[model samples]
Target: MEPLDWNKHYDLANLPKFDMTLCWNCKAPATKVCSGCKETRYCTSECQKAHWKKHKAHCKMFGQMHMMGELPKIMKKNEPKYKGPSMGRCSGCNVRFTPNYPPNDKCPECGYTACESCVVHEVRGTCHCTNHNFGRTYCIMEPRWYHKNGKTGEPYIGDRHPEDPLHEYTPDMYEPVERQCNNCKKITKVFKKEYWNPQRFNTSWF
Candidate 1:
């Protein structure tokens, strides 16, 4: 048996227990080697300048991590929340902003936040024995299809067996709406229901 490299196993750890190769100013990988005297490192143009004071004495020592001829493989946060526009300095006063979400990021928590459309597009999965993409869904609160009937033998419906519910709407939801975008162009849409009820009954009893 051998001691394992924690960095390799815990590279994505969120808590501050481990030190990541982050630019002193911003919490990003210091992958870009400094060109000035070729003895410093930073993640962006701004960090390069911000870290100069600290990195000046280390010119003869290790400067920064060279990009291994590869753009770091970043896992995209699906439907990442759009926290408006952000502009700020890093812990070392280096300014930068990412297009995704704000800077106070952790792995698992950040992975779940999403924007409106991506939040509503809906998702599904397949059974191991027979792969299928059943759209009609159910949840204890909303997903209407796959809910547990609470009857003798109904399985919990449209739940996470496939994936968490996305678009939430039961069958009887046919309706339309009109709106205008920032350009003032008219738009209309009908958020149709997921499943069509086959247990039809007469509507004339009113």
Candidate 2:
């Protein structure tokens, strides 16, 4: 999708010049444009093939886009909204739950309904044991949320198990704990907060 403020760009939009003297696949300018995409000009088919290794993924799906002048879909941001409940029903063939009992199916009956495409999970609790797994893990508390926005860059209260992908946020997962340095032969770890404030290692002023 277009960036947030795309309407403002309509007047300023500039189509790239498909300069047909260089390689179109690489945008290096092409001696001949491919009759297929017409957007690329390759010095030789060999140049196109060499570039294909990196370009194939985008090439197949992008072929029609290049010719038809349409942009690809943009990815949604990662973090989920922390709303209270399902306001509507599930689009994924969900049935309504009776008021007496909680909806105990793949889909839920209450809280704000999301576009099925947008919904990651129907249940609200963090820690993956959504449906009362015997372990019944604790809800990853917000304070512990990724070590309070620690440098690890894991989301707050991500899934707890180190094996779980979100485990990266758990302070204990990566531990930032001491490790034997392969180079120095001394124990090493991430610099402590005393020495590593974001302003020093992060924001800068020239």
TM-score for each candidate, following the candidate numbering: 0.19, 0.22
- Candidate 1 matches the true fold with a TM-score of 0.19
- Model 1 — which ten-residue stretch has the worst lDDT? 124-133
- Candidate lDDT scores, in order, read 0.34, 0.37
* Candidate 2 Cα misplacement greater than 4 A, ranges: 1-20, 24-29, 69-206
Q: Per-residue lDDT of 29-127 in model 2, one digit per residue for the tens?
A: 467555555555587788878766555444544466564553432223344544334444432334344465333332221233333333333232222
Error of 2 at 129 (Å): 77
